[model samples]
Target: MRDANREWVFAQRPDGEPDMDSFELRESDVPEPEYGQLLVRVRYLSVDPYMRGRMRDAESYAEPWSVGDVMAGAVVGEVVESRSDDYDAGDVVTGNGTWGDYSVLDADSVAPVDPSIADLPAYLGVLGMPGRTAYFGLLEVGEPKPGDTVVVSGAAGAVGSVVGQIAKLNGCRVVGFAGTDEKVEWLTDDLGFDAAVNYKQVDDYGAALDDAAPGGVDVYFDNVGGPITDAVFPRLNVDARVAVCGQIAHYNDEGVPTGPRKLPQLIASRAKVKGLLVGDYVTRFEEASEQLGEWVATGELGHRETVVEGLDNAPDAFLGLFSGDNIGKQVVRVSDPADD
Candidate 1:
């Protein structure tokens, strides 16, 4: 075991887009496990759009990260030492852990991870929070029906990718909007989307959406919530359901940017727009995990991951999300669980 631990600490809050100055990579002494706690070496960590929101000094569902504090997120790690019966050495686990080389967490806070089930990094992506978010938000909020025209924004992203697949599994015609031609092709040619729109190349978003979704959108799973969402409003069918999962397009905005008023369209269509958080479905995590695992095991659900090596590169991986640099979930590999 190493005597020194490295971590990313919240340094300065960003006014617009986050950069290297936003966080400081510092080294400290490794902490030991106390009573009912276990020491784990972080193998992989997730960098998500939601983390951007937490950086701001604002009131939201998640508490804001104070400057000078250690950055935190979902992590998969291997326990090297334990002080509780619930966890033992050599056990792999997943939980809300810090962005660091090592973390001492309460045994109850982490659930055991089985490497035989899936790839280790998958726990930070498909089999973790993003997967659960897509599962509950799309099925429960969007309530897609058979033959429904389901439109998804950020279609190539972690959560959006899963949403599109689940909708397809339910027999819905799926349409997706992404920023690049490559992502659009992956959504349509690979993921079985009925149609894919390249938002960056389009002149008129509403026209593009209309062309892709000729039958009209019955269920819309929105991840990027700027022009794409505005355009979707006019194309929504009556009694449409919109799952407002994430507003990645606006996460970096210094202030709320004005957009087209589309509430009237919602009223006219009698549509329902609901925001969701994965934590809200904690009670049903097992149910969703079980089904998603089955789909992955049977090859019904497919996924991709963009991995950034090294703990020091975590910030780079996180900033890449806004640029659409990742085709799917962005994960930082801190170390190999089998290594020290």
Candidate 2:
């Protein structure tokens, strides 16, 4: 049904970190879905640090890829045509889609989203995987309580935004760490975080954290697992919890470097540090969605997206994530699905 197509495939392997040439855009036939599948025109494509791991051949939670394949990430699109009863024409949905304009997917693979509650792009951000990541990682794993002080690194990104808000909802005093002062302002100003530290501006992270949260951290939401996390590890209160969500800072590292050991922090604090994958909480997606939607509807929750126009800018937008160029959720507007 398409007259023109431009799709990006992994062009070359990255040596240390990825660059624009790592992806190649080429023309192709617009794909159509088969039975139990829906043909969707991608509207918005998400950019996340977890995607960095996918670019590597190293073993991780998800499978790695060979060269000359479409890189995978979350995408929100409109169903132009459907071979299943689940979706109809013009229905906006979000799911695992490649970096392409138009693609076919099993209807079961994507979740139907209602635009009445929020925008379609939000399904790929605050109300989607990042939402679920924050929901389960905080409540289920970190177990924040009323009056607890919660501290989250990468506080301005997709998952961190929701994590801070949810912590506020639970009556916890929230402090956050971000790469820039602007992000720090957004966290404390718009997101209801009590205190935020611009990590780049701070000289000693441990001291700055102490100044922000004089009571010590009760829940540690670790996103950047390098120095920022190392600083927070020693500040956890007795019986405190830590949710190890992401390590964007180290994604580009050629090799793991040794640092000052903190075995004593682990024992003395008696803190629980747990690594989580969003897929593990698949059963609770509906529950999390319902609550997040309710919060959004009530205006208790908010999210931001750094949208990059055009499909061609996808690689640059993704590349900017490591450098802290995005404010909240990073997305590429591939094509206008409404025109279809």
Candidate 3:
């Protein structure tokens, strides 16, 4: 049995973009599970754009991570020891655990993970939060119809990638906006998107979006909300649905940055734009998970993972999200599940 634990904590709040100095890694003694707690041996930890919001000392849907607190997110781990009747030693589980090698968490906080359905790391990604985000945000909020032109921003990242694929599954003509030519090709070739634009290479984003979505966008899934979103507004069709899942472009801003006043476009097009949070559909998670799992199991959906090995490298994996360094879901493999 392991006797030591390593943890990453929020050292300081970032200004614009976070750096290595923002985190502090420390070693500690492994914790014991209490009556209703289980000792988890972490295998994989998720790194996401939403985590950037938690770094700031500001008010948001999720509370900000206080300085010196263990940075936390979705984690997949195995039970090294258990004091709860619900779990046993060697059971694989997933929950909102910390960025640590091991954690003693309340038994009710975690859900059993079936390695038979998907790979272990997948529980932190496609079979987990990102998949749920895409499912509800695209279907419930975007409400795409058959043959509609669907435009998705950040179309190559975890949630965005799933959003585009789900749009295609709904019989929509999917157009994607991504950072690089490689991501564009992955979207168009591997992911079956009708069209994809490299936003970074395009001289004119508006013209590029116009070319990709000639019929005018009927559904817009906005993940990176900034200029790409500004470009999409003018192309919205009447009664179009826009699912605002994220604004990653603005997550690092020192203050709220003003952009094009595009409410007039909404008025002219009679479009519907609403923000989405996956947690809102907690009651229907099983429905979404089953469908997403089926899609994964049947090869209808392709999922990718960009992994950084070792728990000490977790901060680097997290920092990479802002710079588009990952192809799909970004996760840190703390250790092999069988290592324990």
Candidate 4:
């Protein structure tokens, strides 16, 4: 049994942009669990744009972090020992572990993770929350009809990449927007997105969108909302559906950005734009997971992972996401051969 624990805490809220100083790496005595809790050794940690919103001292769909509190995130782990009958030692598990090498969680917080179909990290990426977010956001909200033309912003990232693939699986013609040409290449050449635009090089995203989807945009899966998103709003077809999954551009922004106005365009096109969160769709996860698992095992839904080699690199890995440093799901390899 370990006598100590190491975890990252929120050091301070950022004024405009988050810096490395916002995080504090700390160590303390290992926390003993209550009767129903289990101690898990983290294997992989997830870094997502939503975590940026939680850092601010403001009202949000989730709570803001108190200074010195453990930052909120998710991890895939192994139950080293269990105090509850619902779990036992050596059970591979997945849950919200945040930025820590180990965590004590209640029985309800952990889920059984199958490594035979997917390695432990896949539970954090392809078959986990990001996967669920993509599946529901695209299928339910975007409603991509077989011949629909879909455009996904932040297309090279975890959720965006997955959304593009799922849209393709549904027989939609998918185009993606990424920050870098390398990411653009990865999306088109590797992930099967029909077209990929490097937003950094494109002065007019709307023009690029038009060039890519000459027929008109039937579905817009927006991961980044800002000038780029504003450009897309007017391009939607009459019955176009927009799934607002994230706004990474706003996440790190110093202030809320004013736009070129959308209601007018919304009225003109009768397009629909709705914000989406994966937690709201629970009944469908099991069904989606079954299908996703099948595709993953069958090599139909291929995935690429950008694994940062160590736990300490977690923050760097997270920050890199906004810069398009990762082409697929960004995960930290906290430990390999986790159960020694």
Candidate 5:
């Protein structure tokens, strides 16, 4: 174990969009585990869009981070010291952890990682929270059915990618909206999305949707909200189900985002729009995990990850999310696993 630890701390709140000035890397003594806790050496740190919401000083499902507080997110790590009977030294686990080389986590809070299932970082992506989000959010909230036209925004992203694939498995016609042509091809060619629109290249999203989803959208899994979502609203089929996941398009906005009132369209379509928070389905996480793991193991489900090296670059990885820098899950590799 190292004698010192390096961790990122929230330096100052951003006025609009955040940059390096928003974080500070600090060195401190390595934390020791207390009873019912374990000291883990973080291997991979997850950088997600939802973390951007936590940076703001506002009331939300997740508690906001205060100035000078240690940055926290999901991490896959190996236990170096244990004070609980459930886990032993060298056991790999994942849970809420600080953005640092080492973090002390409650044993009860983390789940053991099976490297045999997939790569360690996969625990932070496809086999972890993001996968679970796509599974429960799409199935329970979206309620896609056979022959339904399912549209996913940010379709190349961690959650959105899985949403499209799962919709395909449910016998639905999947159409996706992505930023790059490469991502669009990956969705349509590799992931089996029936159609994919490169929002960056398309001058008119409504026209793109007209060509891609000619039958109208029956289920809309929205990860990026804004113009793309605006186009989708008018194309909703009757009794459409819309799962509002992440609204990355406005995460960094300083003021209220002004857009076309979508309620009228919602009324016309009689759509059921619901916001999704993965934590709300915590009790059923094991069920989702098992099903997702089975799909991943059998090669029925596919996933990708964008990895940044070192803890120092964690802030950069996170900031990149707003700019749409990742094709799939974005993570920072702090260190390699012991067995690796």
Candidate 6:
């Protein structure tokens, strides 16, 4: 076993957008597992936008990270030392873990990973939280119906990609908004989206959306909230359902963000809008996981991952989320499982 561990810590709070100064990497002793915990060597570390919210000191759905606290996220790793009967030394697992090379996790909180299902990193993405979010958020909150025009903002992202594909499976006409032409192409060509607009290139998002979704949006799955979202509201058909999955556009704002009044439009359209958090569906996680796994195995659902090479670059990978630097899910490769 290694004598030392390296981890990232929340060193400071950002006034607006975070920079390298916000984090500090330090070395420490490898923690010993308690009676019900297992020491696992992390192989893949998941970097998600939600982690940004955790950086703030204010109250929200997730607990805020205090300065000097070790950063944590979903990780896929191999158990190296076990203190419980539920896991063995060689068993691979996934759970909430520290942003370090090794983490001490409660055995009950970590689930055994099946490599046959998909790649290991995939457990942090398509067959993981992001996948579940898309499944429940779109199906339950958005309530898509056949022939309905389903529109997704941040459509090339981990959750949005799945939402669009699931909408297609339900016989809905899917349209997506992506940052790059390449992402737009991937959505329409490979993901089977009926049409995709590159929001970055378009001078007027409303006009672009009109061209793609002329029938008016029946279901809007919003992941990036800003001008793109403002454009979507005015185009919503009566009885439209909106799933407010994320508002990444304002995550870095220092003060309250001001935008066009959308409540009036909502009243006119009689649209239902609801915010979603994946944790709300924890009771039915197995149901979603089983269905997602089946879809993946049958090639009915497709996924992609952008992996940064090392833990040293994890911060860079995370900050990239704001710049739209990744397509699909972004993860950091900490260690190779073969080395274990």
lDDT of 5: 0.93
Instruction: List the pairs of residues colliding in candidate 2.
Output: none
The lDDT for every candidate, in the order shown, is 0.91, 0.88, 0.91, 0.85, 0.93, 0.94
Query: Which ten contiguous residues of candidate 3 have the minimum total lDDT?
Result: 331-340
Worst lDDT run of 10 residues, candidate 2, spans: 255-264
Q: Which pairs of residues have clashing backbones in candidate 6?
A: none
lDDT of 5 by residue, 1-340 (tens): 5678999999999888999999999999899899999999999999999988889999999999999999999999999999999999989999999999999999999999998989988898889999999999999999989999999999999999999999999999999999998899899888999999989988999999999999899999999999999999999999999999999999989989999999988888899999999999999999999999999899889899999988989999999998889998999999885433
> For model 6, what is the error of residue 281's alpha carbon versus the real structure, in angstroms, after optimal superposition?
0.8
For candidate 1, report its TM-score: 0.97
Over 4 Å off, model 5: 338-340
Candidate 2: lDDT of 186? Answer: 93
Q: What is the TM-score (0 to 1) of candidate 4?
A: 0.96
Candidate 3: clashing pairs of residues: none
Candidate 2 per-residue lDDT over residues 293-318, each given as its tens digit: 99988889989888999888999999
Q: What lDDT tens digits, residue by residue, belong to model 4 across residues 27-111?
A: 8777777798888888889888888888888998878889989876888888887999998888988888768878887878778
| Candidate 1 C-alpha lDDT tens digits along 1-340 | 6678999999999989899999899999898889999898999999999999999999999999999999999999999899999988989999888899998888987878877767888888889999999999999999989999999999999999999999999999999988899898888888899898888899898888778888888999999999889889898899999999999999989878889998878878899999999889999999998998888777888888899999989999999999999987899999984566
TM-score, per-candidate, Cα-based = 0.97, 0.97, 0.97, 0.96, 0.98, 0.98
| 30 Cα displacement, candidate 4 (Å) | 1.9
Task: Tally clashing residue pairs in candidate 2.
Answer: 0
Query: Which pairs of residues clash in candidate 4, taking residues 3 or more apart in a chain or in different chains?
Result: none
What shift in Å separates residue 94 of candidate 2 from its native position after superposition? 1.2
lDDT of 6 by residue, 1-340 (tens): 4568999999999888988998999999998999999999999999999999999999999999999999999999999999999999999999999999999999998888899989998899998899999999999999999999999999999999999999999999999999998898889888899999988889999998889999999999999999999999999999999999999999999889999999999888999999999999999999999999999998999899999999899999999999999899999999995655
